[model samples]
Target: MLIDIFHDTVCPWCRIGKKHLFDALAKWQEQEVHIRWHPFLLDDTVPAEGYEFRNFMQNRKGIKAEELQHLFDYTQREGEAAGVKLDFEKIRLAVNTKLAHQLIALAPTNIKNDVVEAIYRAYFEEGLNIGDINVIVAIGTAYQMNATELKLQLNDRDVVDAVVAESAFARLNGINSVPFFIMNNQVKVNGSHSVEVFLEALNSTALLDIPAKI
Candidate 1:
């Protein structure tokens, strides 16, 4: 089955969704799955470099006083339950996710998934500034990607244009949020969901009857 996922690197909820989906994938090793990560910027209007995530959340979500405490508490507990370590305090910013998304788009097929997971871990768990070029290069280097070449490609006009086009396509397709999963090009599963939901989708007639290995 093919799963087209639209998500942003800085989205905590997206991380939760990925954790749940991965859990389901691990359980269904016999089932062949092809995953594609698509670009979806939460704040594309932001500058090339992003803004501080804490302030962005505070202003955007308007969580103050007791509400803020409750929100964090709930998120932390939920993250723990999902097996994702979310270090919100260490998170400094939520810069433009376009660059990160672009990386995912251009990554070679063999390592694209690993690259996506690495960036997610860097932002959500390690609390690193994912907006910076150096940080991105560091992550890419771990996968033996050419950091110098990546720096050049990061701002390549063609790459930027392609990413922008993808973003516009996503918007036109009615994607209003991150972590949106379009299963088998038919069912749209929005937001984070339990492993059961993924399992059910995979077991449906749409995805069943995998061709036997030769």
Candidate 2:
């Protein structure tokens, strides 16, 4: 089965959703599955250097202090339930994830999933600024990708355009949220649903023409 996931690295729900998807897959009994990660920028207007997390939320997102606290508390509780530890305090910057998405697009198929996970952990867990070119290069090197080659690809216009186009296509298709999952390009699962919900979607998709491998 093929799973195409549209998500952003900065999205707390996306990270939690990924964890739930893994949990669902673990109990699926199907051993063979292919996943394709797609790009979706939550805020395309963020500058390359990025903004302080609190300022971004307050000024750009219009989130007041109490509302922000409520969001943090809610997401942290939800993350814990999904087996993901999200330290909102550790996150200092709200960055432009275009380059990070480009890196994922450039990743080799075998390591694409690893690259996505690493980016998410780097930003949400470690609080690294994934928008930085050097940081992105460092991540690629750590994942066994050639740093020089990856850096060059990251600066390529064609690569940037391709990822941008993907985001645009998603928006055109009425997908305005992150962590959207499409099963075999047919079944659409939106938001951070529970493991049981994902399992049900998977089971339903299996009944389609392409029987899921079990």
In order of listing, the candidates' clash counts read 2, 0
TM-score of each: 0.90, 0.95
Q: List model 2 lDDT by residue over 36-86, tens digit each.
A: 888998888889988999878877668798888888889999998888888
Error at 14, model 2, angstroms: 0.6
Q: Which stretches of candidate 1 lie over 4 Å from their true place?
A: 205-214
lDDT of each: 0.80, 0.89
**lDDT by residue (tens digit), candidate 1, 106-129:** 688899989998998998778887
Best by TM-score: 2
Per-residue lDDT for 201 in model 1?
64
Q: Which parts of model 2 are misplaced by more than 4 Å?
A: 211-214
